[model samples]
Target: MNAIEKLQSERQRVVARLAEIDRILGQYEELQRIAESYLASGASHTADSGTVTDSVKTQAEAQREPSVTEPNLPRVKSPKTPMVEFERVVIELLSEAEVPLDRSALYKALLDREIVIGSPDESSDLNTLSARMSRMKDKVVNVSGHGYWPKDRAFLPGGYVPTGVDDMPSQDATSESGLV
Candidate 1:
């Protein structure tokens, strides 16, 4: 009924429980060994029948039916095309932005998409993307430092003032005299 007696009683119970668990674990280990031995013997028998496990299709079954499978040929990888990968990405980015984007903005967009530029000449690099975009005059129109946009008028983004239009004098100018 005192603290010392209570502590001793609890310790004894814990020791007994641990001993029971150890006994159970030993039996499990022995069962696992027996299962492995039985499977090993059974596998030799299956090997004698000449097939391994996708539910063990036997040699007899293989011959009694036509094997529809052709022999496993080496896989041939298709050749890569000559198109620059980043060029496509740049087009897509500009299309999504709907505005003409410069190199830095396009670079930032690429970074936002987790694409880091590699080197000066790599397709994903800033210089390479700029060069590639410059060459695509039919596809993209430059807007100075702002960015690039699709060349078609319908695809041109809102708020864009086309060159020379804002600067040109209105064609409606007439002489002040009211002569017909």
Candidate 2:
């Protein structure tokens, strides 16, 4: 095809794609409205039934026009706890913990304090937290499978010492012996 014709064709395709996107956005908005109405209509009633009614299902299906289906599209969710706040809460939890806190315990603590505002999936949330902790090497220390400890050793519970730490000589001993 000639350059002019090809350019026109591309333009037409872009316009068509934009229109499709607009339609999909509208459908999502309608779905959100329906969900909001359902919530406002006392979702407890639905929960008591323990099964979705056919009418509600059909109504939703009818509202959605058949189109290109991309089942893996990412969902836009509520904002997560800010990085600074997350780090602060984690430090607080670790410092208060008597011993190293395992991932499950830390996750539970975070949830209890409402600091974990990330994914609803437990594994994903754990992974995210693990990654964050890994990056906080200067602020926290991981005791292998035992869990996390505050980098500030003083924050550790009284008489609690991480494994392998006892094997190392103290700075005082090394300095006194002129090992520095």
Q: List the RMSD of every prediction in angstroms.
A: 23.5, 14.0
Summed backbone clashes in each candidate are 6, 0
Candidate 1 lDDT over residue span 54-155, tens digit each: 222344543444332223322221212123444566668876663466777877787565343445343546676676667888767775555677554222
Runs in model 1 lying further than 4 Å from the true structure: 1-83, 114-117, 120-124, 153-180
Q: Number of the top candidate by lDDT?
A: 2
Residue pairs whose backbone atoms clash in candidate 2: none
Task: Go through the candidates in order and give each one's C-alpha lDDT.
Answer: 0.50, 0.60
Please give the range of 10 consecutive residues that has the lowest summed lDDT in model 2: 171-180
Q: Over the stretch 1-180, how does candidate 2's per-residue lDDT look in tens digits?
A: 999988776666555455555546645654464465456454442242432222133324433534332333334333366667778889999877766888889989987885644777888999898888888988888765568887655322232233455533323222222221
Q: Against the true structure, whose TM-score is highest?
A: 2
